[model samples]
Target: MISSPERGGTVSTPTLRQILRDQLAPADPRILCGHDRLDVPVRWVHSSEIYEIGPLLTGGELLLTTGLGLRGLDGGTRKHYVHDLAERGVAAVAFEVGRTFDEVPDEMVRAGSAARLPIIELRSVVPFIDVCRAVNTSIAAREVDELRMRALLDDALHDDLAAGAGVAPMLGHLADLLDAPVVLVTAAGALVSAHGVDDDSAAWRVVDRAVAEVPVRSRGRSLARLVVGERAGAPTVPYAEALLRAAAGPVSVGLTRAGVRGSALAARLVEDLVDGRPLRRADLETRLAGAGVTVGGPSVLVPLAAEAPDPRMADAAVAAAAFDSMARSIVDATVYALVSVPVGGPGDVDPVERVASGLARSTGLGRTTIVVGDPVGIDRSRPGADASRTLTDSLRRCARQLGLAASAVSPAGAGRRVHTAREMLVDEAIGTLEPSVRAELSALAAPLAAHDERASTELVRTLAVHLAHGCSATRSAEVLHIGRQSLYQRLERIRVVLGFDPTEPSVYASMMVALRSLAAGA
Candidate 1:
């Protein structure tokens, strides 16, 4: 049986019994069969005499018809006709018998009974239009009631936002209004907030049975999902869907605001350690303590580059990787996390390895490169900031290496692996050239850059590829997806622009370094 809400809340549509007793009482309506389904909500009223009208209906309509269409049909056909209407989810079939038949057909009655579809007969004089008007009026009234409830819910959410009470109170208010539990979970399935339920309780099972789910998105990428429990009765799916749709925007904004606040604080901690500012050990310890990070311990600076098509998704993946770490920050496309772990103890895995393992298992970032700095003591003697800077530089170099490997024809060595800062120091030095040297290098590529700006040519990129592949024209052509002749022509163009042969070993080496430096933002 369907149960409806009280008057103050959204009202459900009028049921067949309610329509018969309240609206069609003057017509002396009586149930001919299927008395058990009187509570089925009548979505609308449709008047038709078409024998095969099932396909025309969108379901949940009370069908009103005279017996004229059944006059020539056999009993089996008549039964099939009623069965078709029932299968189409007609709330009830009201038949007026006097014009076409002396009494209700037993075949239709038997079919309605078998299908448990409500069948009614209008015995008194009543116009079909009158019944349609009454049902439509009732449906409109229910819609108005739902609109009022929705308005009230929207107001409550806005008030909560203005009052600075956060999303929990708004979710609680929604839970009370709908009389169902609500849960907000991150894209990683981490619980952000819940109302009227405990995660461990049986009531939370209702979340698993959510009738509506709305995505909470930020920067055009989904960050979380809001799940609303189904109401016990009264055709609540539509109401639930509407409520979640309205709430999703505010919820996403709230989550983003919270993240920004947290990220700002984390960024401060990271900046203090990597910005080359002199930070006394005592002052650093005090700030770390305030940020809930323990200092004077073995800490590994882990730099990670995760691949994501969208920047927001990359941020989210990095955030997930930083969970439970001492401190973390997103600098450009890379994420750095300072993780603390036991040093050199039995069964003590490398801190960077441990964190990378966790990130690999949790984040679905397709190709990632992790650079681990040597473990350092965060004390007065050791320069923690300098070490962090070195780790960051190493991460940048590894990222460039990974990018180059991806663009190569032979990418057999592009698999993800952890590298130490020492292993990448030479590339880091070359990429992080002094400002005066970088200016000179940029001048060398000025002609190609100007050409790219004017004609959108690939001269600079072609030169970079040729140099990166050991000046092998064939390999560069294969990587660039161009013929060797086209590659030679581009090389000739570069030679004219630079006033030198690019394939010469001395010139190739210098130009390659300059291009690599430019690519690394030197």
Candidate 2:
């Protein structure tokens, strides 16, 4: 039997054509059938007389045997044997004629032709051991060549790392080696770096095909994914998998270093603005311009809140870089950006919404809240001026709204109501009502709160559900997953505890406001 290299390494056995054309084997090996499949690779060589050998194969085998096992077998049995070998993906069947039958069986030839399984006839002069030796020698030569190529690739990557070259050079080198496009992306699918490709190309079709994705990790956490597209006339599958595995480590190191440096720069800039530090207008403008943001004219402050924290800000950075906006993380779960709206631009095109949509698509954060503030000029000379203060206040208010939205089971109902600048400002003002007024509102729900705390009852939730369903017992019961009798009993208990008329309009309005105020942490 031919000895093959270990699986999942940069080595592959020779194909069927190589074995026939090379001088290592006997001079006149003949293909009896299925000549079209001469290029299939021969993974191994096996010799067996057992007819039930289909269960023993792992595919891509060149099987050799004599006709001893098929001496008394009928025509149907002979055809069945060849069909079984074909179904098991045996690369080719080589039979020696002198051992049993005078010539090859016609039934076996027709079955091999039908299944497209290459059938080769070996003359009496060539021993079976010679065939095995030739195949093994070819596999050994392939392994040696793979070792040399792998060394060259490793040295190239080492040189890049030593020279402080960034991710682009690494990816470009990898693309040249594979002869196909390569892309690096965050876990959320934001593009980090790409080489030898464009956004619109047929190579992107490989993203949805049998893609080879390798994870890039740092400090025990995954930072990004390296994707290698399929190349035409590439090596075997195991060799490709090994190559990707080799490339992932250095790519991860480069990405992590670059990400840390970028995050530090962005954090300092954002922290200064949030804390209202004094700075020259020219300096601010220069920094913003470097990031592709034009802040000389009118600009709007856009605050974005995510349901979870993205520590590296990789997704947001990609989105911001794409739209030529300035983005920085203000908190663990919130980021703020400034986007320019051209003067005399069409009113119908809302730049804030466009930025928000782009970020949502990139970050894959479905419940993100994007709040837009009124336009303010960056030319204001004084630190903590009215314009800067307003922008900062709007950011804080937007952050509060995000927290409120995340706590609710369904944020789409009330969270979506705070869209415009005026609505956000009004909500902020209303949220800061006098302590005495808040206390007065709190008294409206004191009874239900006490009962819920003491008896572990759902009185507050029941009241909210009842009010939400327009005080309809039937509808509320369905929503609460309780029977009609149980819902009525709970409503009667609520009325008794509050000492109020159950159907009074004035009482209902007061209780609704009190519930909202308590939920808002008033």
Candidate 3:
């Protein structure tokens, strides 16, 4: 048996050339087999002990011997030996001629080859150690070449990151490097930008929406996502999604660098503007444009300020790594930072308020209220004046809704915007209100909801749904597949218990919202 550090164990089935290479010069050509370069590492053995350790040997280990090892063996016995060795994961068999049975054994060769094991006979004298050394040297050189390539890649990345480059230039550069197109998206799945020209909106939307949410806190920021384009004719969407997600890291950083330069400068300037306290949008735009980001689009500017749950970078690093792996697996974008903070500035309703409230409820942060400003659209091409004003106005509004210290953005907002706290919660609240009322009504309706002896409860539900959909008796009758008079009678019974006329528009709206909210809460 030979011990291999790579396998972390002793291998019983050995390769002849590898054993020779380990103990001798690894530069000799005598190790060549079938006119092909012998590249596999292995150890040699001439003893019958090969059978005992065969099962433990992973394939690719060469075996060496002469006829003396199997002298006097019958055809059946020899075939069995060769078969057993092959079954044990032996890579090849080498027979040294001129020792104990000179001519090649047809049975052994046939059996070994049938097992896909390369069996060779030495035609002339050759030093085994020279063969081993040759293979070892070649392998060492190959490893060195691989290491050099890896080093070159690392060096390039280090240089790109050193100067605070953005994700766009980096994406464009990578696309150039890979000869492919790249795109960056917001977590909510909006396309931030793309490198190439093939516009498959469907594919883009699918990938963008499927990406993981980057946990972040950006005031009034929409969620951002990252997407990578697949090569033409790619058959699998899932695999393609994963590939793009894996590529998002570098792409995200690239776009961020390209987009934030102006924003960062503008941010500093804004601090100054607010300090003296007379803000001119144009001045801010000029400063922002100088930093290279256009502030004119219908983009909302969201200031990110959230204290991390764990102050140590260690937790952040772990989350980043997890997010990276998840991005690779799910083609989703993610962020590693706190996404909540105190509201500042004019009475601005911090959008993150909703997310915080939900998270707080889910995580026990406490009762929270949030306010949000309407979305401000930014034209991508003219990304200066309009964007800056929109952002400023939105921030001011956000400050008002969320209490002074209760407002904040997600940490991930450094890159992009997601839904604000109010939008998310209002939507949540709207969804659950009505369903809950109906369920409470369900107990009242249990005798009624379940009382179908005359199908009165079902008729009532149908009447309600129809009235909820449209108060027309004709429409309700058509929908319920019943006569108009039967619907009227059901409505009367519903009114008796539910205590509201379905025809009253105001009453209907309240009932609808209540039912919808109740359902949503469920």
- Which model scores highest in lDDT? 1
Q: Which candidate achieves the best TM-score against the true structure?
A: 1
lDDT of 1 by residue, 248-347 (tens): 8776665544222234566676645544455565665676666766554555444544323222344455566555645655443234455555465678
- What residue pairs are clashing in model 2? none
Q: What tens digits encode model 2's per-residue C-alpha lDDT throughout 196-225?
A: 676624434555553477887765656567
Output the TM-score of candidate 3: 0.29
Give the range of the ten consecutive residues with the poorest summed lDDT in model 2: 1-10
Candidate 3 lDDT over 309-425, as tens digits, reads 111211232223221101000011221121222233467554345333333333322222223335333344554445444544544444332322232121112122223534334
Q: Candidate 1 or 3, higher TM-score?
A: 1
Tell me the spans in candidate 3 whose CA falls farther than 4 Å from its real position.
Answer: 1-165, 176-181, 186-188, 197-229, 234-424, 428-504, 507-522
CA RMSD of each candidate after superposition: 19.9, 19.4, 18.8
